[model samples]
Target: PALHRQRHQFVIDFVKQHKPKKVVDLGCSECSLLKKLRFHREIELLVGLDVNGAKVKKHMYGLAPISTDYLQPTYDQLCIELYQGSVTQEDARLRGFDLVTAIELIEHLTLADVGLFSAVLFGYMTPVAVIVSTPNSEFNPLLPGLRGFRHSDHKFEWTRAEFRSWALKVCLDYGYEVAFTGVGQAPQGQQESVGFCSQIGVFHRIGGRNGCNMLLDDDADDVFSYTLLYSIKY
Candidate 1:
């Protein structure tokens, strides 16, 4: 649970540093991270997408601005939205965002779906930066009574070397460079050997920002597969 908080904080710190106006969270079940992100004054547009429409709809109202928000308005406007869809599908609304995050989400998909996700996010959406976090299989042995992957739904968890190898190939296929870091240190003696409980990859596009030009594009070919569930403008 502490590591989960750290994952959110890690993205928050990134927003503070980069001040990305448009951000989206892929596989944002329950909209928890989106709720946390709504408070940042720098973000103009915040979007969350998940395949489970009912789950997202159930918690999305909590993201609405409170009475205090209306009484004491900020200078910048924030448009928050939730959508129901698979991450492997391309949506016109998601393209060209300043930041994209997939927190503890990749491991849930099968290997084939993972390939589709890479192509959709890195190739189609092409955000300026992307943050992805997944459990480190190497650390599973340390958890008491834990047998297989952390979640029963997780198709496959990658060991440190396996994760790095996949990330490196993603960077190469897409024009981005990646840096690896993580939260949840191992026990003092085994820290060096097991690495973090959750591993993260931060990716930045190469060649002077390739996706900005299409930020406001209205091309007919652009697709909108995700169903809009809720939206609020402030």
Candidate 2:
């Protein structure tokens, strides 16, 4: 399943609002997000980094068919670059894209390295905006003793508050004001519920010289009106 699809409106709103020239999808597995932006050719460059470069190269040929459908003209012709490198140690200097997304990738990192990882991203790229989504620890049934996300690799899952605290502290240390938001909106939903609710956070880097200043303070702006099991923005 493509997570980018789950948050398509956010991406559209984010793009139409910010209009970043370059984009980097960190921990990008199949570069699914890049394929979706095929219609917007003027976005300039796209660089995707993962820990396994060979994996990206292999998928390029495998996804060739998927591209022909919507992401036509092929990525090689679209000026998209995919490489295998860890978001934790990846050199984003030349990869300083307008927007960066690490959806569902945060919980895979060690609790201590996450903040450091974000710092590394800012230190080199300093993108005007960033989007991060992780499983809200409050809902992580495997946490406290079961390990993070029930993944053999994930180091930790973060509560809404914990995610935002890390977001604020990291950006502040790097000289930027940050605004957070839930990824999956519920404002227009028909009813309120928990098992059906999802969590996410958007971190906008302020005064960076590019990207738009987008913030959402409407507490009722979620996928539901009032869900006791879900959490508030941090």
Best by lDDT: 1
Candidate 2 lDDT, 39-110, residue by residue in tens: 455566666666656666656543232424444544233456566556666352333467887767877787
Sum up the clashes in candidate 1.
Answer: 0
lDDT of 1 by residue, 78-171 (tens): 8998999999898888988899999999999999999999999988888999999999988999999998778999999998899999899998
How much lDDT does candidate 2 score? 0.58
My TM-score estimates for the predictions, one after another, are 0.96, 0.69
In TM-score terms, which candidate is top?
1
Local distance difference test scores for all models: 0.90, 0.58
* TM-score attained by model 2: 0.69
- Evaluated against the true structure, the overall lDDT of model 1 is 0.90
